[model samples]
Target: MLLKELVDTAATVAATRSRLTKVEALADLLRRLPADEIAPAVGFLVGRARQGRVGVGWRQLSSVMGEPADAPTLTVADLDALLDRLLTTAGSGSAALRSTALRDLTSRATADEQDFVGRVLIGEMRTGALEGVLLDAVARAADAPGDAVRRAAMLTGDLGETARLALVDGPDAVAAVGLQVGRPVLPMLASTAADPASALEVTGEASVEWKLDGARIQVHRRGDDVHVYTRSLADITHRVPEVVDVVRSLAVDDVILDGETLSLDEDGAPRPFQDTMSRFGADAPRETLLRPWFFDVLHVDGRDLLDEPLSARLAELERVAAEHRIPGEVTADPAVAERVSREALAAGHEGIVVKGVDAPYAAGRRGKSWVKVKPVHTYDLVVLACEWGSGRRQGWLSNLHLGALDPQGEYGEPGGYVMVGKTFKGLTDELLRWQTEHFQSIETRRTAHVVHVEPTTVVEIALDGVQRSSRYPGGIALRFARVKGYRDDKRPQDADTVGALRALLPGA
Candidate 1:
């Protein structure tokens, strides 16, 4: 298939912002792909392609393709060619190409359609939902089982492999998919609900395990061999070797356990997220130095226990993780979750992910079934020009330039707004490194952490509150709006709309 056709389909999907349309676009793109290339293509889209991390953005892709110019230009056909190069290199390209390839495409996008294509390429394809929300759409389009297909893709990080197995070997391959990698069927990932009332309704129980804020690790054991994967299931067997040895020394032989791995000091105090992130960023992560706290279990003794309820699995995980478990842990009832949450925060974690004992493992699903109760604060802000980022974050143009919302158009200068603040906070350093590289690529001028881009990526920013200010584009300032992480699950258009800003004023 021609690259233009793929772009057109992508454009159609973005234009409609319909899940069905996006799935159809993916289906069309897959049909044109050779059987062998399908997995690589999907993996490239959803799974990241970075060293130590999963994404290096377009620059990495461009470098992989050997595109001319420090920053390359990409045509639609360029994506397929780019994928071919990535697969040929096994996605092991110099940093330059991978970063440029995605950005170059994003740089030239003029329409909503192009933006959609760009979103998919970067794995930011959020239409107000998580990736799993679209799995059913994909399955419907491809005429396959949504659950099996999503799980297979998670295990292999390749939608094409899932498709091929479904088409060639039958549902058996899809069923046995995670097993090939020695994983039990995918483990359930948990989150927390914002409202305690909502949490009670969802779990239908007075008991739950408040979740932790850290990287999710899934450990798969085969005899003595151990492979560990992140929440996205990318193999981190090398970066987290202590985890490998920890799992290796565990009492069980064939099992898969899910847990959180935070970089903690010997005192068992949780390190700053940055310190923990730096550990992950290290080419040689000191596994012995890196502490992993096991939280849950999904498989044991060749039996699938996801259906066995959280209470049973928790017990099972503890039995296997006997030697390697994080000490002083117990199942906290729902009423005490508030107390547990205090310990999580006091220990320097974000919040807790509460899980019900009776809930089955719902792989690749996030809803009230699994809530995410992030402690958030809101701020009213005006959109300013966007900027880019670096390293693993390259080509994203993830950073933002902010100003207070100027609703009256009351500025004496160009529209009455001032650039008051800039922040790289609330983002994983992985996010930071990736954005740093991205900002560098699109930099109009450079002196330090600032690089201006087209005012294309707008966002609804939440901060602890505002402070009196004179330094930034806005005379008034946001106390902590710092990139507050990303709105990848949202479109630039969907940013907190201007009408909503009035709520911040006492006498609006």
Candidate 2:
């Protein structure tokens, strides 16, 4: 199929607010794609390239200046092939070669296609073809059960591959996708609650576990081989040999465990989050030994427990890795839940997560079955732009223009971010210097004082609460907002939404 065809379909999807309309448009488009183009087309619609991070930054992309093709001729496969070439083009002078190739490709694309390609390359495609809507569209196009498609996608951790399987190989092939011992599945997420008592009200007879302020890790072990994946499912096994050793020592031959890992000081207190992430993101493991603490087990031996209740999974978790199990208590009493929360907080952990004892594992879904409570109001928000610093902090990016995701376009474009507030507080000189260099690398455009960037960086912000205001497009601004840190583990799409922020309004 032509790239224009996909671009036009994305436009159609973006022009409407009804999810049904978006799904129908994307389904129609998906039905017409050839087998070879299914994955690439899905990736383009979702604003992710098949070749992740092709070394083409905004600077390189802006360097390409050429006239667009008058007519539609570029195919989806052609664009995918070009991205593949760009991914593999690395060495001295590789930048020049990649730029030349990008120019050649853009020169052949029409104006709309150029814009679409640029957005896709920079991870800014906001056509409302969200993964959830696109998954529904894939099911619609394939005439498969939506639940089955969703389950397959969650199990495989690859929507593009799931789309290809469902569309090309039929629903049976999609159904055949199952939990692999080596591959990583999407980690389950939790909703936020005011406190453990509030969370327990939502989840009766709950397991209140410590909410650690550390990196999320998913460990999959088969025989002696172990793999560690981050929240986004990127493998960091080589960077965390300590975690590998822990997983390998588990009693079970094959298992899938979800937990957190962090560096601890001599006092057994968790190190600063940045310290852990710095070691986590390193190319080689450092002397800081990360200890693993398993909270839930999804698979054991040859049996899959994803469909099992939390009680059952925790039983299995305790049986195999009791020593590594995160501290928690299973109770229906609100007082006990509060005690656990207090204990967790007193121990320097974040707070507690109250999980329903009867709820099955809902991978990639943030439903009310699990709720987290912390004393401070913290949110993961996107950095929309950065202001040039002044005075003593001159020449650095100091103030951050923060935005919350607006999935339904209630205040702006669908799937785009609505600016909530700005903050120059809580940033150390190191962060200011780092962001000054980093933001420019991903900078989309700039003014004399502000540098606008692609909405991609995710930063954790602590706030007193949100107050209604007309100063921003979202009609709510973060009160007393300050940066906790940059969440290198989160993606822009994973940031909290505008609705979530509005839910914090007084009497809400």
| Cα lDDT tens digits for candidate 1, 1-508 | 3334444554454345455656666666665655555444444344222221233343343333322333324444445554444444434454446455545654554344344444444444423222443355446545778777787766654455566676556666677865443643444544444544456566654333444445567788878878887664556778777778777777777888877777666777766544554555558535536667776676777777766776687778777876554332234345565666666567766655555667776664443555434465443343344555667666555556765433222332311234556655566666656655545553334445455532323434556645555554344455667653332222232233222333333443
Q: In model 2, state the lDDT of residue 153.
A: 90
| Candidate 2 local Cα displacement, residue 96, angstroms | 1.8
Q: Per-residue lDDT tens digits of candidate 2, residues 1-508? A: 8999999999998899999999999999999999989999999887777788776778788789488899989999989999999989989999789888999999999999999889888888999889999999999999999999999999988899999999989999988888889888998999999877789889999999999999999999999989999998888898999899988887889999999999899999988888888876658549788888889999999999999999999999999999999999999998999999899988899999999999999999999999999999999999999999899899999999999999888999999999999999999998988999999999999999999998999999999899999999999999999999999998888999999999999898
Q: What would the TM-score be for candidate 2 when compared with the true structure?
A: 0.99
TM-score of 1: 0.64
Error of 1 at 7 (Å): 2.2
How many clashes in each candidate? 55, 0
For candidate 2, give the lDDT of residue 3.
93
lDDT (CA) per prediction: 0.53, 0.92
Q: Pick the candidate with the highest lDDT.
A: 2
CA error at residue 153 for candidate 2, angstroms: 0.7
**Root-mean-square deviation of every model:** 9.1, 1.0
Off by over 4 Å in 2: none
